[model samples]
Target: MADEENRKAVLARVHGKVQGVWYRGWTVDTASRLGLAGWVRNRGDGTVEALFAGPADAVDRMLEACRRGPSAAVSYTQLTL
Candidate 1:
């Protein structure tokens, strides 16, 4: 497959007690560990936002993890590209 086809970009918005719960830190660490290139930040609406670009499978794994989130987080909504 082509490099572009093997890569993907994901935008995730996590909700339900995600803020002030180390969500961003966990996301950053996970992304780094997965060799993803992107960033995670807090939104003004009490949500955590992240952009992840990496191998398709790795990105998908990360997205799955985001759905459950850390112990403190409750839920997540993701958009993939």
Candidate 2:
């Protein structure tokens, strides 16, 4: 659909118990599954940082997924849209 092609982007910094919690790897997998194109990395200030660029819906889904995180990865995410 045309809507799926509409690109969107967001730079998110997820905080709280995110660092050293495999958050970056979880983000990468989640993003990939959502068909998003971006990268994730850990910040020195105890956060997980990522840039998600893709179809608008997919990007949105990725953000939501990041909030819940992947299984037992204690993360309280705070992202900026």
What RMSD, rounded to one decimal, does every model reach?
1.5, 2.2
lDDT of 1 by residue, 1-81 (tens): 698899988887777788888888888888899999998889899988899898999999999999888888887675744
Candidate 2 lDDT, 1-81, residue by residue in tens: 776569899999887777666778888888988898988888889888899999988988888888888676776667677
How does model 1 fare in lDDT? 0.86
Each prediction's TM-score versus the true structure: 0.89, 0.84
When summed lDDT is taken over every stretch of 10 residues in candidate 1, the lowest stretch is: 72-81
How close to the true structure is residue 64 of candidate 1, measured as C-alpha lDDT?
92
Each model's lDDT comes to 0.86, 0.82
Return the clash pairs for model 1, or none. Answer: none
* Local error of candidate 1 at residue 26 (angstroms): 0.4
How accurate locally is residue 47 in candidate 1, as Cα lDDT from 0 to 100?
A: 85
